[model samples]
Structure formats: C-alpha cells, structure tokens
Target: MSLANIFDTAASAMSANTVRLNTTASNLANAESAASSIDETYRARHPVFAAVRQQVEALSFDTLDAGQTETQGVQVLGIVESDAPLQQRYEPDHPLANEEGYVFYPNVNAVEEMTNMISSSKAYQMNVEVMNSAKTMMQRLLTLGQ
Candidate 1:
C-alpha cells in the first residue's frame, strides 16, 4: 500500500466509528423509552460494516503482477435493529400502559450500549492516532532529501 493511502484508510475508519458511536448513543438514549405496543417500541440499532477493496496495478513489469486487490477501508453496510425481545412490564397505573396493564420498553441494553460506545470511542481515537503518525512519517520523509 502507498503511504498516501494511510490517510484514506484512517479517515474511513474514523467515519465508520462515528456511525457506531452515534448508533450506540441513540440506543442508550432510547433505552428507557416506553411504548404502548411492541411494534411502537424502539429497538436497539447497530451498524454493519464491510471491507472495501480496490484493485491496484502491481509494482512489477511482469504480466502476472498486473492486478492486485487491497483493502481500502471499512464501509458501513447499514443499520439493523436487534432481534431481542422488548421489555414488558406490568404497570397498571402508568399512562402509557396498554389495556392489559402492560408497558412495552425498548430492547436496548444499557450496559451493552455503553460498552459499544466505549469501543467505538477507542477505535476512533486509534484512527486519529494512526492519522497523526502518518502525518509525522510523511513530514520525516520530506526531510530525507536534505
């Protein structure tokens, strides 16, 4: 891989991590939300990621080295709602309670969401560090001519 590709890779990672953090935050925010029906309740959302690949010309003049594949970075496929069951509680007096005296809560797990948040944050920080390191390396390379 070329040195310049480092920036693109890191940038893509940072973007993917940002999406993960946002989804985690949203899950946490709706963790306590209540709904009158299971269909209306919020579901824990998660982002799916996929590896992005690119075809590059081989560095050699040989015909066998014509096309090579390299991973560019990560791409978010889409956000998916968790299949976990929603929380149902008997709260007869609650305003949002259904006729059956039950309230439906989102399936979000606070602890899991918190863990995801932390992981995403750490990943983002790591990407930032990678970018900084790449920048420093590029600067040092500039001085190699002198």
Candidate 2:
C-alpha cells in the first residue's frame, strides 16, 4: 500500500468505531427501561463491520505482476439488535408490572455497555494517533526533497 493509503485506512476505522460508540451509548441509555411485554422492551444494539476490498488499479510495467491480491480497509456494515431475552423481574408494585406480578426489562447490562463505550472510544483515539503519525511521516518525507 502507498503511504497515502494509511490515511484512508485510519479514517475508515475511525468511522467504524464511531458507529460502535453510538450503539454502546444507545444500549446504556436504555439499560433501565422497563416494558410491560418483552416485545415492547428495548433490545441491545451492536455495530457490524466488514473489510472493504479496494479495487485493483492498473499497475505500471515495472511493478506489474501476473496476479496481485486486492487490499482491504475497515467498513461498518450496519447496526443489529441483540436477540438476547429480556430480563423478567418480580416487581408487583412496579407501575409497569403485568398481571403476573412480573415486570419485563431490557437485557442491557449497564456495566457491559459502559465497557464497550470506553473500548470503542479508545480505539477511535488510537486510530486518530495513527493518522497523525502517518501525517508526520509524510511531512518528513517531503522535507527530504527540499
């Protein structure tokens, strides 16, 4: 890969991490939400990612090979809701309690959601650092020709 491709790869990774952080935040926000029925409860969400293979461009005679593998970068496919069952709590006095003396609550774990958020944020920061480092390296290379 060329030096300039570093920036593209880092940018795509940062975008994917942003999606992850947003989904984590959403999960945390609804962690305490209660529902009268499982169908009405909030479901945990997660971001899906896939590698985007870049199209191979024509190569010059000097560097051309009989066959070459395509390069890939990170990509966010979409967000998916977790299928975990809702937690049932016996809260007869709860306002949203059902006739069976049970209150259906979302399966979102606040601690796990918080952990995911932190990890996603840290990953994004690291990607930023990578892009910055690449920028610095490119600048240094340019100075050599001065």
Candidate 3:
C-alpha cells in the first residue's frame, strides 16, 4: 500500500459511512409510521458494505509481483430491510387500525437507529482525520526535499 492509497481508502470509508447514516436516518424517520397491513408497513433499512480489491499496477520492474491484490477501498453492496418482526399494537380507535383492531408499526427501533447514527458519524469523522493525516504527511514529505 502507498501513502496516496490511504486517501482513497479513507474516502471510500467516508462514503460508506454516509450511506450508513442515511439508512439510519431513514429508519428513525419511519420508526413511528403505522400501517394497516403488513405490506404497507415500513421496515428498518441497513446498508451492506464490501472491501474493494484491485491489482496493483506494476510501474517498474521492482513492482512486478505474482498474485498480489491490494484493498483499494470499501464498496456499498446494497441496502437491505431488516426482517425483525414489526410492532403490533391493539389500537382499535386508531384511524389506520385493521379489522382486527391492530395497527402495525415498523420494525425500526429508535434507540438502535440513534446508536447506529452515532457510530456512523464517528466513523466518518475518523476517516476525515485519516485523510487529514495523510495530507499532512504528504506535505511534510514534499518539504523534506526543499
């Protein structure tokens, strides 16, 4: 791995964390939403991530290597809805209540979502710090020859 690659890795991590934060916000937004039917109920969502790997380009004779792969960054595979059971409540007087007098709520847990948001934000901040540190190191390297 090269120093420049650190920036790429940190950037990818920040992007993934942004997606995570978005999903957490979405889950929290729909946490209280109620639906009359299972199909209409909103479900908590989460983003899946995978590490991106690439073959390092051989820039010189010394760089040539066999079967060498480096992790470039992170990739967001996709967003998935949680399969946990939805909240079922007996609210007969509720306008959206079903015939059985039960209103279905999203499976989103507010506390969990909040915690996820905090975690994502911290990850993003850490990535930012990483990028800054890389930048500083690069700058110092450039000044060394001056």
Best by TM-score: 3
> Model 2, 11-129: lDDT tens per residue?
89999998899889888888889888878989999989998977665455676565443565799888888888889999999999999989888888888898898899999999999
In model 1, pairs of residues that clash are none
Candidate 3 Cα outliers beyond 4 Å, as residue runs? 56-71
Over 23-124, each residue of candidate 3 has an lDDT whose tens digit, in order, gives 998888889999999999999999999989887754444655544436589999999989999999999999999999999999998888999999999999
Compute each candidate's TM-score over C-alphas. 0.90, 0.87, 0.90
Runs in model 2 deviating more than 4 A are 56-71
lDDT, candidate 3, residue 60? 45
Scored against the true structure, residue 26 in model 3 reaches a CA lDDT of 87
Best first by TM-score, ranked = 3, 1, 2
TM-score quality measure for candidate 1: 0.90
Every candidate's lDDT = 0.91, 0.86, 0.91
